[model samples]
Target: MRSGKQADFAYQAVYRYMIDLINEVSPDVRVKLPSLRHLAERLNVSISTVQYAYSLLEKEGRVYSVAKSGYYALPVSAPASYCTDADLLERLYAGTRRPGMQVLSADEPAQLLSLDASLLQLERELLRRHPLQLQPYSQPCGIWELRTALAARYTQSATRCWQADDVYVGADLRGVLEILIEVLGLKGAAVLVESPCDWLILRLLRDAGVRVIESPCDESGKLDLMQLEHLLRTESVHLALFSSTASLPPQERPHAARLLEQQGCWLLENDIHGELVFDPSTHFLRDLVNPGRLLVFSTFEKFIGPEAPYGYLLSRHLSAPLQRQFLLRAFRLSPIRQRAIARLYQNGRLDQHLRALRTLLKEQAILMDGYLQRYLGARLSYSMPQAGATFWLCSTQTVDMRRVFEHLLARQVVIAPGELFSVSGLYPQHLRLSHVFNGNHSLDRVMEALAEALKYGRIG
Candidate 1:
């Protein structure tokens, strides 16, 4: 080890040199470096003082180090400076505060602050039973038992049965889409997307270099399959993605899926809204599953709770070896969180919670419809879902969605803008109102605020 005196001298010299170099190369300004040899000789320092300063420059990434060559200045361009949206998106992810203008910008559930206690307790119990390893990565294939449990849940279908090995854990649907786009070689490839599809998916796929072909949705809320077929015949399509029957009426899904398959395109189904409870009589997925043609995506966050740690992906035709490889390389981490999720399912809490949630959502949907009809008159038109945690409200051209959003936010009311759900920025002048309020009190307040917001909305 170097003597304390030598270490101090080296540290001082290196710090000064780095500061000078940074200032000189930075576009904003310039600064001076101390005379290396002069300072070294003046202080009875060795020639190594100057050499040490130079070496530290390369070591700290301030300069480039080369074999058999001296250091050179680093190219001033940082990775963030070159990449698109890296800074803005990073800031968005880091930002925790809500927007000051209005409550509608985010997709946060209204009762999250209060009802999270139960979820927290459940998570605590899970941790108590099976400890989590925070540092190591999760099992590449996700929690095996959880996958098995999920697979079993859908086993009634003979043609589309799955095993625990099929589920892949991701942060969210965006995370899964990223991997899918990369693995499917979809960069620069044409993608057939619904015109009013989920905005997040459209934006993410576009950012991934996938060209989108937007097809209008029919009155039934299913993809206009005729337009899609024409596009497939006329232009090359790498993939066709859409939300499943949960968003659209159950009667429309199978017909749409059959039409989609005739185009010879790969299908990607995002079933994030599926967990909101389905009627036992409705055979929504009866004929929609064709493993050779479909890949399904779903999340536990909406049904289990927004903070649920896992997302599930299913592909019918993807080979086992490739699937295994994807899991091994992608996960290679711990499966504790997924296992916890499985245990929740095993304890039957998921089903019980979903039952209560559906009941609340259905009640709220009715309440929302009644309020809009009675208070707003004919100014708003809402297309009520037969099942789901949310409903959409349409507004006239005279009504500015943004202004109304601001007005409601000031009154401590939050809702989602119509543009948030639109695929190509063609908002239908609407708002997506959630009915997931955990208690009766907040739900009533939300309806009151919404009615009041609409009154002033026409002129706001």
Candidate 2:
């Protein structure tokens, strides 16, 4: 990378570090950010580079300057959206008038993310050494070497006591989830999911004969704890899967984890976005919760492409029966693929790519946020996520999003509609826009089409 790109990377690194620091404490407690010279020296970058980062953060309202001491982190004082679950649940699904409209499909494959050039190059080099050997069927969960690497990563800084024996691997995220559902006998179990949860997850639960209850979350993607506690107390929920994604591990995260544990509910940490956090040395929920009661599943596909075979399951309490069932049904990853991935861990390339990816994501967020503010600011409502490639949005007006989606589809603009995220199709106007803002898609064209769709979608 050239000096310009390096400077941009340095700026984002400092920006994300400040974000992590701000989120680490309660909003009420004031926290100061490192000085420009101090941060630049620590990061080994020029002081001017840090100055540019601090200025941009102030522009974005992420920090404030006192003119004397230095900058301080800004805490999230209020949620961006405040709609209640009951209110939104009362809204019907936004059915399209042109029910057969040939608009875009919400389900777009991970092209920029999936079929990336860098990841492909890395794979090609690894495959030359590891080759395409068919995996042996000895280790049902995974080979010991790969699992050991994952355990070491999970046990970063000696804060965690993860063991290779506690690790399990699967071909993909969906397959791993399927195994958990079957092994747990969740055919008719009651589960509590966050309102506006990922639509695909909701569909999977529905298919598994799971009775899911919803608790609405705010714009920051945090659910109402009182409602969650009530449901856990009354519903006897088998498991609770929700996102606690932030730049750094929020201190408040433990409260929710502890609540579920106190209720004797199994907690599944959806570490998809969690793993992609900008700060490389952030904490994880595993430190707060008992491992026996938690099952953490995450995919390596984010780092490598989607075809890069491996998703893992980590739990300290892997029973013999569950292990037996896993061996009987789970797909044993190819030996070569396991070795290649393990090599990624051993060489530290994985960590390098992660930092670069996080910086790139933050860069993408700023680009997308600028355009969204310029074009669809009034038409749509959203909060720039602290991490991840996707943006969760809700329409300002209650319109038929299904028709709006179709319109955007006709323009070759793919976006996830609100109905997919809710159990009752409550968020008729909510939608998720992904992958478009990362310089992969034409920003001007996508925004033009999106604005037009929302215009036609405005109905009482």
Candidate 3:
């Protein structure tokens, strides 16, 4: 009904209004926009004007239309300044790759390059016994056969003499921790956590409403016993969660354990990476503390493949309560997976796999450390881990870690910033690099990119 000039002016006005509305609302992706008629009425424009505006937005990839539904807003690509550390972490984990992108951010072990002949044989055996081994539902605690085998392995290793009853298998370490957090009534209680601890666990404690107190450790990752003692004496600390083997070197572990035991606070030891240690005798942490005061949990997902997602907790005191919580939570693990793992352990295949994995991890870690030294040298400082695959790295005083993180991210080499690990945005000059996921083939390229990024500061 209008002239072309009038229509164009009307559409432009409607477009400007829509842009202002989008800026005001900041809608999420797939969020429905106002209906065409509604938008036209609000803008005091013709329906054609609104349609024209929507068409322009769609062409610009700012909106999408669904059949029988109204237009929906596409996720706005905000400027990097608006992105938070958590957002950057999520992008890294989502594996957003650009051309020439080399990801160094993953914490998982590298995919097995080739099939192990022994593992293949085990797989064939598993397939042959598939139907016979299948069960309707897993036991509330877990498959008893797996628990018994794990108990025997623990006893043989001299870690602790755990009976099958004391070992309760769960979906994963996180799930086990959740159950423990609820059952132990950790809500609103003061919980002690190590500085630069596991970020995921720190988030878990916060979400559970626990007052998290950081117990700062020394350069060697050993808890300061005097400070910890002072905290224990002053504050009503409920529990202290830490990595016994991974964080504390062997010689320091017994003393640390003794200190923890004397404090009388409940201890939760994370041994998820204990099995991958190059030297088992010096890296073990089970025998130091009394089981009465400590509850230890470890995951097979790190050693065995992620496909076999199960973790076990050893605690005579809390096993019954954990089991009750598991029942209430309906946290049923897969019997088939449990049976497969138990078969691997029973036939010694698991031990062979572990030995091979440890060797591979050690090689990868050495390669990564060498690359770091070659690339960054004095600009970046780090202590090589004794047991785990991750290196805790810090930037020198001259280097800005935030700028370094931005540079590496731009280069498509994603590394976890140290800010993600702390409760109070501490350790801005730090990074955590895991060499386990990326193989040696990518290491050279990653180092080259890292060196370039560091040298150039921030690149387009």
Candidate 4:
């Protein structure tokens, strides 16, 4: 009976009601939507209003129309995760295990950066007395015991109350990502990635057949959010993957996340260094977005220990049954190791370790940044190390990075070329210097080699 703009409003209200009804039904239901005439009669609205509502719901994939039959509700199901070439995965394991013979080439903390030996000894003694046993998989989402511990840690944060069902622990960042990709239907889906992103992510996207549109990063070293916004508007990217914290300048992150959400895109947050950020402004992205739309990947190795057995993934929307299936299919739980580790973290020891490490790293970053500026002069400045061990170098375009890398290698000094992280592999002039240099010896060796290399036109 409604007409004019009021009629449009009536149509929208009816459409939302129908969607709610469809969503409330069990996944087993076919949800044969009522015919337009029937719906109009039942709701006491015009056939045009019913038709418009149906059209809108169908467009959103909440329902579908058969050629001759009426529309039916679509199943609330996720997409399958598919990857190619286990060989690449085999290579990744091989590479990760070797731990870069050249000490500074890796991003992990200095071996000395761990908790003081005294604390480790104390932890070991405590574990020895407790001697735990492996138990049946606890809830498959993760061990509930660990979730309870984690929830307690974040209890004071701005986030809503977190439950055991909201957490999922996986083997590592990649494992967590794989599970998300599989359940989210990102395989063969379009994705927007930073040009010089984590190489492993690129590999994962490639294997999954996801088309990647690269965003150019600026010299201040943040991903260009404008480009990202443009792409999301024009392209069909369903996901945007980013390191929640990186050696580069803090991302124009909220804007990027907003753009993605506006375009109905999902965000995959690789918070590998999430716990390490000393700056308050560069908070974790998971803290910014709706948990249902964000999948956060975090590892404790950055703060506690690298070999820690468990990694935590936080997501709010994943159903319990899907999480259980993922746990059984992709990984087997090791309860004894997880519980033992959780005990150390729960007793305030982990907080102490993280605080101490943050202090040490912050001081080291200042020292390294100042040293790099003084020695390399105007053309070289350390990337904004908001927090984390990798010191990015914003080198002049004139520098010959290959020669500098080779010269440093000859001196037994190893650093990652900035190109290693680039999507197109086109950035040869930039470098990623490691702050994990063992005292003055390694730092001095790198400085001397770099000075000589610059003189010989080996690098600018």
Count of residue pairs whose backbone atoms collide, per candidate: 9, 3, 0, 2
Q: Estimate the overall C-alpha local distance difference test score of candidate 4.
A: 0.61
1 or 3: which has the higher lDDT? 3
Specify the highest-lDDT model's number. 3
For candidate 1, what is the TM-score?
Answer: 0.67
What TM-score does each of the candidates earn? Answer: 0.67, 0.71, 0.75, 0.69
Listed per candidate, the RMSD to the true structure in angstroms reads: 13.5, 19.4, 13.7, 19.9
The Cα local distance difference test for each model comes to: 0.56, 0.65, 0.66, 0.61
Best first by TM-score, ranked: 3, 2, 4, 1
TM-score, cand. 3 vs. native: 0.75
Top TM-score: which candidate number? 3
Which window of 10 residues has the lowest lDDT sum in candidate 3?
Answer: 110-119
Per-residue lDDT of model 1, residues 197-249, tens digit only = 66557766776778888776644455554566688778888777766554445
Q: Write the per-residue lDDT of candidate 2 for residues 1-460, one digit (tens) a residue.
A: 1143133245567767766766675644556788977987787765544655665555334565543577765354422122233432111111111133221222222333443454445445655554444324467787888899988877754545788988888655655777788877889998887677765477668878999988787766666666777888899798887664652236666777778788888877777666566565666665677667878887776556543535688877755755786676545455555666777788887777667677777777778788899989898878776766777888888788877865675665656677768778678778877642334456787788889999988896
lDDT of 3 by residue, 152-264 (tens): 87674344577888888776665677788888899999988878877667877877888999886666666676787788778888788787565565676787677767777
Alpha carbon lDDT at 17, candidate 1: 51
Which of the two, 1 or 4, has more lDDT?
A: 4
Give the worst 10-residue stretch by lDDT in candidate 1.
89-98
TM-score quality measure for candidate 2? 0.71
Residue 332 error, candidate 1, Å: 6.7
- Residue pairs with backbone atoms closer than 3 Å in model 1 (clashes): 137-333, 137-334, 138-333, 138-334, 139-333, 139-334, 147-164, 148-164, 291-316
**Count: clashes, candidate 4:** 2
